[model samples]
Target: MPARILFIDDDPAGREVALFNLRKAGHEVTSAADGREGLAAFAAAPFDLVITDLKMPGIPGMEVLRKVRAHSPEVPVLVITAFGNVETAVAAMREGAYDFIGKPFHREQLLLSVGKALERRRLAAEVRDLRVRASGVGREIVCASDAMRRLLTIADRVAATDATVLITGESGTGKEVIARRIHVRSPRAEGPFVAVNCAAIPGELLESELFGHARGAFTGAVRDRAGRFRQASGGTLFLDEVAEIPAALQGKLLRALQEKTVDAVGADAPVPVDARIVAATNRDLPERIRAGAFREDLYYRLNVVDLHVPPLRERPADVAPLARRFISELAPGREIAVPPEVTAELERRPWPGNVRELRNACERMVVLCRGDAVSLEELPPLPRAAGERGGEEAQDWPPLPAEGFSLVDLEKRVIERALRLTGGNITQAAAYLRIPRHILVYRLEKYGIRRDG
Candidate 1:
């Protein structure tokens, strides 16, 4: 594809040079003299790439970066900065900048960064394609961790078919990532894989979102829309947190699933659809079905194949690799070498929040630590459940449940109490908890524990 380019800078000379080189490279180019104008230009059309100066009058390059991401998130962004302003470049990369070039940068480097960013976007799309094939019908895994492993095995088997698969897992166990992996392994490797979170959208408007609305469907429906089902046509429609879908809308969803057609909001007829379906949830759908909270027929239809992702605590062996992958992705600027002590701490600790907790820890260590090697002393401590971290006063509140009140909850409370005990000093809390500082911060968020801001 011939790429479109946006060049933004306050300096007229700089913008001209960028426009000249990019156009020479055969890309269609657009120029903006300032950040505000640059943003306006981007909003006006879809551009394949954007190269913006770090500093500009009015809105800065950072704000420009934010705007471009908001409008065209997948489009590549390259930052231009002065040689000594490496800090700004690093910040941009942390915020997902594809790459950067110093002020006196080589023409080769600029072109190379732009090319590589586009390639990365291409690769990400390709990966999504491949994952869909990998997880498609006839590829689902089968096992018997009683109800659990058996469920995953069923998913492994169903992944080979084109049936709609519903996956259930806790919040942080990576339910959707599993969905992508399934898609990559499935026959739909060549199709686009689109995902939407049901819980994130409002109950009142979710149907319109799933099914596109007409220009006058309702208030603020200014344009005719194509809902997710149509968008995922010939691909997979992944609905995360499927239980959050409203009861009233379940019948409509069922009709679409049964008939392979969707009637858009305010429209009179149903449009044909060719998308495969894969829904996920953190809630217990069977229980919901029993309680009449979720439609039984819809549950059966979606649960044609069910995959249950194992929690981090259940599979601690995978934590290190998962964490490393996340660290490499999230902390690309910081070449953080995981020290043995840090790795050991990561393993010894219980990750109630699973992969999400590990990612947060990596981000914290990258932000707080000064060097390439992450140290155990830099990790945060585990959280306290209920009132355990406070004192004997915790006992006065309530006895532990027969099943043992959630360790996740107690860990959060404990971390908070420790932070208070140490007066918000992370290092102090780490020492008191007898765990590495990085691990402590990970647990703090896992348990919803936060030091007083």
Candidate 2:
């Protein structure tokens, strides 16, 4: 493929010569007079490679390199400097410049460097795509509601670019699924899709898990291990439960995102990585930030493009279809039908567990159903408010003790019931108890209620 090159030089003669040579070499070329013009052109439309003169009247090449690195670290930058300025060129390389050429360089030298840089980029992208395909890390997105359709549309639009995406929703709302969908539909679809659950790994080990480690880096060091970031190079890294990442690791995570590099444990230098980040979290990050648990800057970096998933209850129209899909997936060979009554019942309760809870319910019904058609009896017990007997007629709430019960115990029980009813969705549980979501989170932490539980 013919690469697109952006050549920025204050010397019109030098610029024209380079432009003409690149064009003759079968490459598309765009010329800019200075660093400012080059940046403006880049912002208007990104190029495959950027070539800028080291000494510009305004916005020096070094400044341009910094600006480009800050915005798009994946883009390769090559500096053009005069003879005896080798030190400056080396400094540029240290600051993320791909390579540098002398002002009086021959045509072949220019062509050779450009070709090498473009080839490196091409190979990296190809490697990423192959890894993703070989790993089989993609799936079809199942959605029916207009709200969901709209969300999918937005996801599709953003997938074509390399923008960072932050997915937010209650637990079991399929945030990771949506992230995968975006990756599969993106230009880097062929690249690997690596997922890491920030909440699943222990806080102490998360850094090593994410950034890899050299042999003997820690107590159990058996051999060198590449971290999730390296494994996900040239692809997408899905960070699930991002809010749960420990405070100490937030700075390192921020640095990686900013510089497109990771310092492996026990390594001498930072290694460059080229993976797109798609982070998902059910917890309220803003509340966490207020509590001084999450870094505000890291939150901003991850939230570059936000995708909020609507809970199952909020999108009632998708419930039956999702339930049917789950049933088919769980009981492939069996002939089973989800009756209208079952679908109606499924939609009536607040599915705090979101799609996951509904899927589990469907699986249970499919396995236990005695006939082809599912009946109300086979379905799981509904929430008190949505039960067949209705909340007024139910005796589920415990009676007050003769010697007054502990308020703390009562509070814990109520929160547990709410979580059970909602399928572990803190947002829905909080709503059921008429308390703020943050307060519910505090209670969950206080009582050690696992979000997954």
Candidate 1 runs further than 4 Å off: 1-157, 333-335, 389-453
State the lDDT at 210 in candidate 1: 96
TM-score of each: 0.54, 0.62
Where does candidate 2 have its weakest 10-residue lDDT segment? 384-393
Could you say which candidate leads in lDDT? 2
> What clash pairs does model 2 have?
128-191, 129-190, 129-191, 132-191, 132-192, 352-422
Model 2, runs deviating above 4 Å? 1-135, 383-453
* Candidate 1 local lDDT, 161-183, one digit each (tens): 79878787766666776787666
Top candidate on TM-score is 2
CA lDDT of each candidate?
Answer: 0.76, 0.86
Q: Name the lDDT value of residue 407 in candidate 1.
A: 69
